[model samples]
Target: MRKFILCSALVLVMTALSGAAVMAAKPVDNDGDGVTERSDCNDNNALIYPGAAEICTDGLDNNCDGLIDRADPTCTAGVCSDADGDGYGFPADPSCSYTQEDCNDTLASINPGASEVCDNGVDDNCDGLTDTADPACGTNPHASNTWQNYPLDCLSCHDQQFNEMADSTHYWWVGDTTEMANQNGTLQGKLTNSVNSYCINILGDWPVCGKCHVGRGKRPDDPQADKTNIDCLACHNEDYAMARTRLADGSMAPSLAGVENPTAEELQVLDGYTQNINAPTRKNCLKCHAFAGGGNAVKRGDLSMSGTDLHGATLLEGTDNNSDPNFDVHMNVMASDLKCQSCHVFQNHKTIGRGSDLRPTDDLARGSEVKCVTCHAGFDVDGGHAAAGANRTDADRHVSKVACQSCHIDHYAKVATELNRDWRYSHDGTPADGTNGPGHPELTIGEDLSPVYKFWNRLSDNYLLGDVAVIDPETGAYPTSRPIGDINDGKLYPFKYKTGVQPMVSSDSKLVALDTYEYLAGSGDVDQAVQSGLVNMGYPSTEPVEWVTTDTYQLLNHGIAPAANVDCAKCHGDLDLATFSELDNLGYALKGPKAQICSQCHREKNLKSDHPGMHNHVDKGVGMDCLFCHSFSRQEERGGISPCDSNATDFVDTNPFAHPECSQ
Candidate 1:
C-alpha cells in the first residue's frame, strides 16, 4: 500500500509540471509555421516580422515608394494626412469610411474638397459642397480664363500661397457647420440632407434653392454652370483670377477682364484653361481702420493679397503684400519684423485645412486670427450699418468680436451691392427710413462719407432749398427744402425728382427728408416689378428720370454736379453753397442786403473787416467750405462736436441761435 501511494504522488507532480509548460507556451498557431510566440514579430500572422519576406497584400504597401499601404492619406490612426486628408490613404479615398473617409462629416456627401457657399448658409457637399457634386473636373475656375463676380481659384498658379491659405482660418468656411449654422439655422435642412434645396427649389429641388448655390460659373439664367466654385480649382485657376490690370493710362484697374464673358467661340477656344495667372501683391493682411476705410468687407485681412504692400520693410503694418516686401502704406509700424502667422499661429488653427467639416463655430481654434473688435470695436467705432447710433445686439453680442469675414465670406462685395441703397439714411441706429435704406458711407467713419450715405436732415440745404425757401430775411427761416442741395447723395443720384410723398413728417421714426418726392422717389426704392420690367426690357432704370432736377438745378452744390454729396460751396464759402450758381439771376448765396449769414455769427466788433484788431479766423473758416462747417457736418466728423465740449450740444455753431433775441 505504501509503495502504491508514493507512485501516485509522483504522477501528480508530473501532471502539474506539464500544465505550467502549456500556460507559458506562445500564442496558438492553427497552422504550424515553425515560428513561436517568443521568436515571432507578428504572432497572429503566419508571415510577418524582420525576417519574413514582404508580399503584395491589398492591406499594405509591401514596397514603400512613399506610398502607404497602397492607399491614400498616408495615415496610421485611420486618418489620411495627405493633402486632402481623405482617410483611404494617399491614393485611395473610401469616402464613407467612418474612421477613414467621412468626406463631409457634417454633410452626407463623401467627396473630397468641398467649401461652404456662405451667406446663404448651405453645406454644399455630397460629402461636401453641401452634398452637391464637387467632381474633380468641370468648367473649372483653375482651367477657365473667364469668371465674373466669382471665386477664381487664385492658388492654382500660386501653389505655395494656396497651400498656406488652405490651412488658414481666415476663410471661416474652412471649418464645419456647427451651432452657428445647424438645427433650424438658415442652412440646417440642406447641410444635413446632403442634397440641393433652395429658396427657389427648381424641381423645387434645383432652382428653388439654386440661388444659394451660385458661384464661379453661375448666372441667374444658367443652372448647368453654377456650383463649380466649391473646390480649390474655383480659386486657383489663372483665367478666372482677377489680375491687377494696368490701364493704358498706367492706372491699375481692380482686375483684368476675366475670360468669363467670352463669346461662344471664345469660350470654346479657352477650354476652361487650367494654367498660371499672374497677379499683384502677395501681401500680408491689413487691420481694417473703422476710422478710415471704404467698404464693409475690405477684402484685406491677408495684406499679402493686396494691391499694395507695407513698404517700410516689415510685413505687419497696414497691408502686407509680400511681393513688394515694402509696399509702404504704414511702413514705419511695419518696420518691426515678425510674421503675423507666428503671432496668431493661424496655420495650426484647429480646424484649418479642412473642407466640409460640421463642427460648431466655437470649435475653431481661438487664437487662429485677430478680431475686428480687437482694435476698432472699442465703444467708439461700433455703430449701425448706416452710421447710426449703436443698438448693440446681434452684431454686437454674438458677432461683435468676430472677424468681418465671419459673416461676409467669399462674395461680400456683391451682397453689399444689393443692400447698398437701403442702408444710408440713419444717424441714429437701425437703417435710415425708406424702402431702400442708406449704408455706412466709407468702411471707416474717416474724413469722408458716401454721397448716398450723407443723411438728409430737417435743415435741408439741397440746391432746390434756395428756390423752395420763403426766407424771411429777418428770420432766415427756409422750411421747404430740396433733397439734392448740399449733401453728396452719391454721384449716382446727383440730381433727382422724388415722386414719393412721405408725409413731410413721417410717423415712422426713420424718415429724414429733403422734401419728399424730390429725394425719396429717386433714392432707389422703386417698385420691384417696375424696376425688373425696366431692366428686362433694357429700358434703363438707372438713367436719370428726373431730368429737371438732374439737368438744371443740379449745378448748385459744387457749381457743378459731383456724384457724391461732397458740397463744394458748403466748404468754400457762401458763393460756393449748392444754390450759388455764378450764372443765377438770384446771384447765388450771400447777396448784399442778403441777411448776413456771417453777421449772424460775428459781433460787428469782432468782424475782421470792421475791427482792425480782430484775429485772422477768416482763413480757418475759408479752409474748407460752408457745407463743411454746418451743424450736420459737425455731427458726422470725428471730433465733429468739439472735443473740448463736454456735451454734444455744447459745441458753438456759427449759426448759433440767440433764440433769446429771436424770442423777442
Candidate 2:
C-alpha cells in the first residue's frame, strides 16, 4: 500500500514540471509568416525575420541584426548626399527611411550640426522644440551648434522673411513712389543709376558699396536674379561694432575697393556677426546712415558720431528750457527712448518713411506716407490743450498753409553737417596723403546750422543719370537736387542745403560717375579707379571729365521740439505786422500802402497802408485799443481767433471797459 501511494505522488510532481517547460518554451507566430516567435528576431514584423533581405539606410532593421538604417552594411558608401553641406544625410528613395538626423535635407545649413533659432516659429535645428520652446535658444541669442554659414544658416528659419525683403526698397534700392514720380514711369533707385550729392554713384564700385548692404560677399551680377543673397546678421546683430574690432586697420574697409577679397584676419571679423543677433536697432541704422557721405556725419547734418545719448539722463527729464544745453529733441535717449524704427515702421519689409532726396514724390504710391498727422492730432477736444488753439477754428487755417515741422523743428545738423565738399581739390586717390585733410578732407562742416525754409509742392523735376543739369544762372552752379513749389502747389517746409562737386562729362555737360575705387577701397589708385568707373558706365575715358558744383536741398524730418505758444511779436513785427506771403496767397494783399482790405472791415473810408495798426482805431487815435479786433492770448484759448479778424472780439470778458465801444 505505501509503494502504490509514493508512485502516484511522484507522477503528479512530474506532470507539473512538464507543464512549466511547455509554457517557457512556447513558439507562437505573431505576424503569421510561417516563422515561430523563437525563430524571428522581430516577432511583431513578418518581413523582419533573421534571414530577411537587408535594405540598408532605410532607418529600419529589415534583416533584424540589431544594426539599423545608415549604420547597416547594405548601405553602399557615398549613398548619403549632403546637399546643404551641413554634413547630414537623407535617403534619395521614397521607400527608404528619411535622413535620420536631419529634419530638412534641402537646406545645407540646417541639420543636427546647426544651431537652433528662437521666436521665428520654425524648428531651425530640428530638435523637436520650436521658437521660444527650444532649450538650445534660451533668452539669450545662444546657438549650441557653433556653425556659421551666413544666409544659408539664416534662411533655414527665415525663408519667408528673406523672400519678403527681396521685394523691399532696402533690397532693390528702387521702387514705385507714393508721393511723386517721373514722367517716364521708370522709378529711380540708388542702385538703378541714381546719383546723390554724396558718393555720386555706386556703378563703378559695387563691391565696396555692397559692404554696407544687408548682404554678404558682394553685389550679385543681377539683383533680381539672386534674391537669396541676404545677410541676416548685418542688421540683426547688435555686436557688429564689437566684431569689427577684429579686422586689421583699413584691411576690410569698404573704401578699400582694391581689396575685393577678404583675408584670414578680415574673415575673423565675420565671426562677430554671428553673435548677439536681434531685431534692428538705432545702432544698426547708424552703421551706414550716420556715415553716409564716406565718414561720420558727412552726409546729413542732423546726424553725428557723438552717440544718440548726447544728453544722457537730461533728455528724459523733459524739464529743460531755452537756457539748457540743447539736445536732439526727438531722439533723446532719456526723453522718449525713441529708436529709428519707431517712426520708420515696416510693412511687408518696406519701410514707411521715404528718403526726401532718394525718391521723387510725384510718383509716390500714397499708402505708406509717413506724416506727422499719423501720430499727433491737430486740434484739441474736451479739456486738452489745443494744438492750434481753442476750437482750432483759426489755428486750423494754418494747417493747410504751414507744415507741422515748420514751427516745431527749430533747426537741424546740431552737431555738424557738411556744408560743402570739393572732391576735385581733395580727391587724390591716395588715402595716406589725405591732400584735403584728415577723415574726408573734401568736406567742409558747419555746426548748429539752421534749415533753409521753402514752399514745396512735394514734387521734384529731378535729374536722372546722364541728364545734363540745368545750370542755376545766378548761382553759376548745377541744381542737382531741388524742391519745386509755388503758392498754389504746397506749403512751407524746412530743408538741409548741401553743396558739393562731382564729375560731369564736359562734351554734353551730363553727369558722369567717377571711378572711386581708391576713395572706397583705400588702395590710393585713382587712375585705375577712373578707368574702371568709365568702363562700367560704358562711357569712353576720352569724354573730358569736368568737375561741376552741385547743390541739393534735402528735407529735414527730425529734431522736433516740445510744443510752446508762439509770441505775437514773431509774426507781427512792426506796424502790427502783415507782410507774410501766406497772407498774400490767401488774397489779403497785406503789403505796403495797400488799404483795400482794411477799408472793407473798418468804416474809415481811406486807410493808406496794409498795416494792422492802420485798421485799429486806437492806433489811429480815433477809437478803442488793438484788443478790440486782435487776440493777444494763446490762439487755442480763443478758439482759432485770427489776430486781425472779427473772431478776436468773441473772447472779450466783462473787464473789457477800455474796448467797450468797439466791442459793441
Candidate 3:
C-alpha cells in the first residue's frame, strides 16, 4: 500500500513540471526585471524602462535613443538624482509630490520623516504654521542645528554642485600641471607649494594666505574632500570682508594657526552672511592679486591700481580723451563695459588664461581659452585702431614673428612698483606687516621702466620648493620666473624685469622659502621662522643659509602705444647706428639682409659719410622707392631686409642685386 501511494505522488509532480516547461516557450522577462522583454528597452536592467529618466555623459545610451554622450540633453544640465524612478526627482522640487521630501521613494516603505514635536509653539523647519498645527508635518520628530544633521540637511540637497567645486583646481590647489613640465614637483600651485620671488612658499602660512583662498578658513593641511570647507561668500559677497587679527607689533596674526577645524568663535564672524551674493567684482579679485608680493604693484609691472581706471568719456572714439594711451588698453572701462571676467572666461569655476610667468602658455598640453586673438583677430586693423600707424609694410612683415606687446608697449609700471626686494637683511624690531602696508622695509621701487625682450614659446622652468637655485654669476641671484623660447620656436615678447634678494641654503645651493608668518607675528624672529620653514618644507634646518639676489621676468600686457604717435625710425632705419646695433644684438639683420650688400648701394651712390644716408640712396639712385630695402617682394624684384630662413646658419642670398636669374 505504501509503494502505490508513492507512485501516485510522483505522477502528480511530473504533470506540474511538464506544464511549466511548456509556458517557458513563450515571451518572458529574461533577466527577471519587472517588465516583459518587448516593453523593456534594457531587459537586463531592472532600473531601465520606457518611462525611466536618462543618465548622461558616461558614454552610455541611457535613454535607449541609440545616440550617446553630449547628444542627450540629460548630459548638459539635469536633476542631480532620481534614484527611485518616481517621475519626480529630488534636489529639484518640480511641483511633484515624489521629490526629495520622500526619504526613500524607492521603498514606498518610507516617505518624509515624522514632523517636529510640539514641545513649544515654534516651527523647526521654518514652515509658516507652528508645531502640531502644521498640516505638512507629523509629531515627535528629532532635529537641531547640530553637526550630525548638517550633512543630511545640506549635502543631500546639493551634492553635485559641491562635488564640482571640490574637484576644481581652485579648491584642490593641486592638479595635473602639464603646463609646468619643467618644475620638479608633480603637484603645483600656491596651495600645494610654489616659490615666488615675493613671499615664497605658503607651506607654513595658511592663515595669512587663506585670507585670499576661496574656501573658508582652510589651512594648507586641510582635507581635500571636505565640502563644508568651501566659502561661498568670499568671492560672491560684495560687502563680505576678510577680517584679520593684528598683533601688538602691527603685524597681522595668522588666523587659527595649527588648528584643524574652525571653532564656533571663528564661525560667528560669518553669522551675518549676505544672502544676495553677486558675480565676482574687480574689488573682490583685486583684494589679493593687486597686492601680491607684499604690496600694491609689487610683483607685476603691467598691473597697478592706476591701470584699473585707464579709460575716459571718449573711450568709444578709440582715442584717449581722458589720459595717456599707453596706460592700459584692454581694461579701460571708458572703451567698453569689460571686466577681468571678460577675458578670463570661467567655466565650472576654472578661469582661463595663465600668466606667462605661471602656467598655461601656448605650448600647454591641454591649453587655455583666454586669448587676445579672441577679440583682436590678428592683422585685421583699420585707421580706427589705437596703433594705426603700426600698419606699415615693414612692421607688418614682423607681425607673424613678434607678439603685439613687444613693440606696442614702450614701458611698464607707469606707476611706482618694487623693482627689487631683499629679505636677507635682518629686522630686529617689530616686524612690519610684511605681507603689505607700513612695516616691511626690503623694497626698491622704479617707474616707467623698459621691459626685457625674449622669444617666448610659452614654456618655462619654474623653481620648486627644493630645487637647486640656478643663480646668475654676475647678479648672484636665482631666477624666480623665466620664459623659454628660441628663434624657431616662437615670437619676441616683452617682459617686466624683476630682481629679488632672498635666502638660500649655502651647503646645497638649494633655494629656500622661509616661513615669515611666525617670524613677523613673533616680532621679527628670523631664526625661529627659518627653522620652522625648513621643517614645513621637509628639509633639515641645520644647513647654513646665506642671502642672495635673484632675477625674474613678468610678461608685460599693458601700456599699449597708439600707432599714430609711435616713431618707426626708432626700430626701422636704413643706417641708424643705435638702431642697427640694438637689432644686431637681438639676431636681426636689420641693415637690409647683409652688411656686405649695404655697401653696394652706398658705394654706387657715393652717399655722404655723415648724417642719415637713407635720403641719398632713395632720392638719387634707388629712386626713393625705399621698397628696395624694406619690402620683401615687389612685381619683378625680391625685397625684404632679412632672409626667409631666419633660423638657418647659412643660405643663398635672395635679393635683386644677388639674384642669379636677375643678374644674367
Candidate 4:
C-alpha cells in the first residue's frame, strides 16, 4: 500500500508541472496591450505595437512596420503650411506631397508663377534673384507702384507741394501764352486753343488727353477745380502714373485693369509705395512724357524714355543695351547725369522751360527760355571748342547766329518717332496684341532722323481753335504750327517736322480737331470721330468736311550730342551746300553776284572752288561782314569792326592772294 501511494504522488507532481508549462506557453497582455511579445515590437510600451499610429515628432515607429517615424506613410512630418493662400507653401518638405516652397510666405503674389519686378528690391516672383539682377527683368524694366488712398492720403504731409502744384501749368494746363506770337499776352494753353499735327487737338478729348494732366479728373482750367483735384501721386509715384484709370466720377484711380495678369512686382502692396514716397525720378517723369501721343517714343522726337542712362539701360523697345552717351551728353549717367528738372529748373512748381509748340509760361518772372549759356556760361569764349589738333573758331563764330542744339544734336528720334499720322482710316484699338491690323491713324515712323533746320526767335505762330488755317507755300501743306522769325532776327534751330491728314471745314478753311478719344474708346470709326469733334466744337455735324494735310514744326531740344561729335560738314562744307538747300532757303543765299562780291574783297574767283579761301579770309580776323556774300549780316557781332578794305596797303600786302582762283 505504501509503494502504490508514492507512485501516485509522483504522477500527481508530474501532472502539475505539465499544467504550469502550458500556462507559460500561452500569450500574455503586457502593459494591457493586446499584442503578445512576438508581435509587439516593444511589448513594454503600450503606445508601440503592430498597426499603431507612427509618432513623427517622437522619433518612433509606433506601428512597428520596420519603417521609423517620418519614414512611414502615416506620419505628417514632411507636410507644409500655406499661410498666404497663394496655393504655395513654405519650408518645402521632400517627404510630403505638396506644392513648391514660397520664398515670401507673407505675400500671396510672391509665388513660383509670378514674374520678377525690376528695381523694387524684392524677390517678387519667389526667384532666387531680386529686381534687376534677374534676367527676366531685362536691362530696362518699367517701374510700378501701389497705393491705398493716393492724393488724399498724401495731403497729410505734402500740403505744400499740393498747393504749389495746384497753381502750376501742369495742373491748370493753361497760363500766359507768353511765347505764342499770334496769341501773345492771352490766357491760352492745351486746355483751350492748342493744336498740333499729332492727334489734331485736345478740344473734344479732355477725358483721354487729361490722362497726362496732373489733375485728378476735371479739366485743369475749370474754375471749380482746386487743390483737392490735384493728383500728387502722378508725379510722386511712377506706377500710379502708369496704372491710373479714369473713375466714374471723373477722378483717377489706380486699377489693375491697366495690365493683364499683372505680377506682384507690377501691382505691389499699397503701404510700400505710399509710405516710401520720394521726389520724381526719370522713371516718374517718363511715365507720361515718354508715352505721349499714344505710344512710346511716338510724339516728341528728342524727348524719349531712352533720353537718359540714369538706370544703366535703354527704355526703348528692342534696345537691350545701355544707351550710348552720344545719344544725350547732358542726360547720360556717364556724362552729366542731369534730370529734366536740371534744365527745366522748377521753383514752386513753376517750370522754366516750354517748347515752342506749347503755350504756357509757368513762371513768367523766371523767363520762358532755356539757353545753353545758362549752364555753359563761357562756351563762346576762346578755347571753348579748341581741341588738341583742331581749331573750331569757325564754329564759335556761327554760334551767334546758330543755336547750340543746331550743331550739338546730330540726330533726333534716336528711337522711332511718328513723322506722320493719317487719320483717314481706322482699325481695332488693341495695339498690344498686334491684332489691330492697320491701326487707327496709320503712323509713319522715322528713326535716327536728321532734323529739319529752321530759323526761330523763341516765338511760335500756333494755329488757334478758330483761326483760319493757312497753307505753307513751301510745303504745300497747312501750317498748324510754325516758328516765327527771319534769318535777321532768329538763330538757326533744329526742328521735328511732323505732318498729318485731318478733317477740315471746306467752307471756312478751318482745321477740325478730331475726337481721338471717341475713336479709340468708342467706335473705331474716324468719320464718326470727326462728327463728334464737329459737334463738340459747336459746328454742325454735317459741316462740309475735307481731308487736308497739316504740318507742325516741333522744336528739338533734348538729345544734345557732345560738342566734339558735331559734323561740321553737315552745314559748313561745300559738300553740304550742294546737297542741302536749307541754308539758301533761310536767306543764306548770295547777296549779289559771286564775282562782284569777290571783286570787292580782291578779284574775280570761282564761286565753288574759292569758298574755302573766302571763309579763310573771314577766319583771319579780317572782320569781313557775313552780309558781304550772304543775305544776313553778323557785323554787329563783330563789335563795330570794319570789313576788310582792299584799298588799304596792309590789306593788299597781307591778303594779296585772298582769292584762290585769282592766285592761280
Clashes of each: 105, 28, 7, 0
Which runs in model 2 stand beyond 4 Å of their true positions?
1-142, 145-147, 181-184, 220-228, 241-275, 307-326, 360-368, 378-395, 427-441, 473-476, 518-536, 565-664
Whole-model Cα lDDT per candidate?
A: 0.28, 0.55, 0.53, 0.69
lDDT tens digits, residue span 429-529, model 2: 33434343332325676766766767777776556677767798846778766667754457777788888777777778777776565544554343444
**Which residue pairs collide in model 3, if any?**
387-563, 432-439, 477-549, 618-624, 631-640, 632-639, 632-640
lDDT digits (tens) for residues 293-320 of candidate 1: 1222122111222232211222222333
> What is the TM-score of each predicted model, taking all chains together?
0.24, 0.60, 0.59, 0.69
Instruction: List model 3 lDDT by residue over 62-88, tens digit each.
Output: 456665544766544544543333233
- Can you write out model 4's per-residue Cα lDDT over 1-664, one digit (the tens) per residue? 9999999999999999999999789686443457888788766555668977665434455788988744776655554555444566644678644457776543444677665656546676777988778888664222222354554666766699788887888887778877778869998777878888887788777878888887777886678877778877677666666667786666775665344576777556444556444446566777677777876678888767644332234455312122567777777766566656656756677777777788778988877887665445335432234211155545655766788888988898887888888886542223212234223566787889999998898889988888898888999999888998888888888989999888899999988988887776666667778898999888999998999999988888888777778788787666432343567778877665555555655654455443466567655544555654665556676532333434334333323323332223
Among the numbered candidates, top TM-score falls to 4
- Give the runs in model 1 whose Cα sits over 4 Å from its true position: 1-177, 181-214, 219-234, 237-240, 244-273, 277-318, 322-444, 447-523, 526-664
Which pairs of residues clash in candidate 4, taking residues 3 or more apart in a chain or in different chains?
A: none
Candidate 1 weakest lDDT stretch, 10 residues: 547-556
- How many collisions between residues are there in candidate 2? 28
Better of 1 and 4 by lDDT: 4
Alpha carbon lDDT at 591, candidate 2? 27
